[model samples]
Target: MYTPPAFRIDDRQRLVATIRDAGLATLVTATVEGLMATPLPLLLDETEGPHGTLYGHLARANPQGRLPAIGGEALAMFSGPDAYVTPAFYATKQETGRVVPTWNYVAVHAYGTLELFDDPDRLLNLVRRLTERHEASRPMPWSVADAPEDFIRAQLRGIVGLRLQISRIEGKCKASQNRPAADREGVAAGLAASDRPADREMAALVAAAPP
Candidate 1:
């Protein structure tokens, strides 16, 4: 996360919000064998610590869960909206022809000590919370209680719980903040016209970026 001052996002609340919205994160760790990475849906318990605590689960069969930790830390990366920015999208390209293609994106990296737990109770609770978070917006929201107790218990046995006590966070939002106002406007407008949902989302972020 080599973020320039203009692209850095230091606000804790905003960073946490982005993480929550991302829903899924790439968990990276240095293992004795080599580097290991797992994509998992993580929930942030903002009230747990000064920064926050992350909770997730991995399939019991996933070898990453059994690896010997090389270092004391793990990295979780959350990616938000991102879009390709063509030079044609920069107004300055027409004026001075000095602008080049770039990318606009939002991302957050969380560093923490890896804590793996297999407690059934904790795993059940974590799964319930995760279910509720994702289901709340659905038309017919589902719950863990909707399933049979035995079935749920059996399913829990197949996964291992993950808890990461966040040590630090780095957030970057490269949303055309470094560009001139007119160029930024051009970027936003161009993105807004694209059919891709991510591009449309980035367009809004770009429009909101400070000059």
Candidate 2:
């Protein structure tokens, strides 16, 4: 979260885009015992608050749900595309031999007051929305109504819903923005040539960053 001015991302639309595109987030909380975290898929209700509210669910058996978040807030970290940048990819390496290896990536952190709910009606609506969000891209979308009503109700009993009213959020994009124009182009080219999907995704980000 210690972001330099060059890497800080303050645009609200960009932050929301990153949060939506990043499929999973690491939800961390402080408890009397210690800090606990869970990787969860969350949905953002942009119209709910000043920033936004997060919605997700956890298994009832998970201790994270039962424990109280000691502080007023919890943290949710969403990590986006990332890739390793080799010195060989920098044009400065040949000019001055001053470049070193580094990483290029995007990350967004959200802080909010954590709230828990188990009301079946609310839980059912959340489940249905979450399902639709994830299934919209599929060739054949799935829905909560696809299964028996009794079976769905029984399944819902095993989980708890989460609501985090975001008080603060920060985004950082370290995508060769600090590098010289030539070096950034080299970095983008190198990453675009990689076989890894993440690397290629990072390449596009780098290419689009201000030179």
Candidate 3:
């Protein structure tokens, strides 16, 4: 996360919002063999610790979960809207023609200590909460109890739950913050006109950023 001063997102609320909206995140850990990462849809408990805590699970047989981590320190990466910014979209390109292509995006890095578990009860609770969280928007929401008790218990046995007590949180919004105001505006307008959904999302973020 080599973020320039201008592109740094210091707003805690905004960072949390970005992570929540992203829904899924990548969890990275330093292992004896190097780095290991897992893409997961983790639940965030904003009230859990200093910054917050992350909750998720891995398959019981997943070797990644058994590896020793760097004193439990792990990084969860949440990525938001992203768009490719072409030099042609910047107003500066029309003047000095010195602009180059770059990516405008939002991301959050949550550093924490990861605690893994194989407890059936806790894993069941985690799965229930995760299901409810995602299914809340549905007209007919599903529940963990929907399945047979024995089957549900069997399923829980095959997975391991994890809780990450977040210690540090860093957010970055590389949305043309370093560009001239006019250039930023032009990029936003260009992105808004693009067919890509991600571009349109980035356009709104750029427009909302302070000039």
Candidate 4:
């Protein structure tokens, strides 16, 4: 994450919020064979460690769980709202024709050591927690207990649990913070009018950015 000072997000609470909101993360590890990455929906336990702890599961067939990670460190990347910022959206471009296209986005990178386990009890609990988190907002929420016990137990056997004890976190929010106030306002307006949900989400972030 090559973040300039203007775009850096160092607030611990904000970083944790971003991670939790992003929901999905790319888990990357440097293995002896090569680098391996898996996209997963992870749960962040902020009280579990200094930075936090990430919990997820990998398919039993996924080799990433079996590989020896380099230095025992892994990186989990979470990407939030993002949108393409066209030059047409920059007021400076019209004034001086000096501005070009850019991207506005938010992201967080968590570094931690890899911990893999297959204990049935722990895996079951992890699945239940993850399920509850995602289903909490639904009108008709579902639960692990809704399924048959033998079936759920068998399903858990096909996955391996992953735990990352986070050591550090890096966050970046490139929401036109480097642009002039007028240009940033233009960007926010442009994004707000766009049809893409991602664009609309970024519009709010751009509007909230410091001038």
Residue range with the least summed lDDT across 10 consecutive positions in model 1: 63-72
Candidate number of the best lDDT: 2
lDDT of 3 by residue, 38-90 (tens): 99999999999878899999887877688868787999999999999999988
lDDT of 1 by residue, 1-211 (tens): 8999999999998899999999899999998888999999999999887889999999999988888567779999999999999999888999999988899999999999989989999999999999999999999999999999999999999999999989999999999998999999999999999999999999999999887
The models' CA-based lDDT, in order, is: 0.94, 0.95, 0.91, 0.95
Clashing pairs in 3: none
Worst 10 residues of 3 by lDDT: 63-72
lDDT of 4 at 163: 97
Sort order, lDDT high to low = 2, 4, 1, 3
- Candidates 3 and 4 compared: the better one by TM-score is 4
TM-score of 2: 0.97
lDDT tens string, model 4, 142-177? 999999999999999999999999998999999999
lDDT assessment of candidate 3 = 0.91
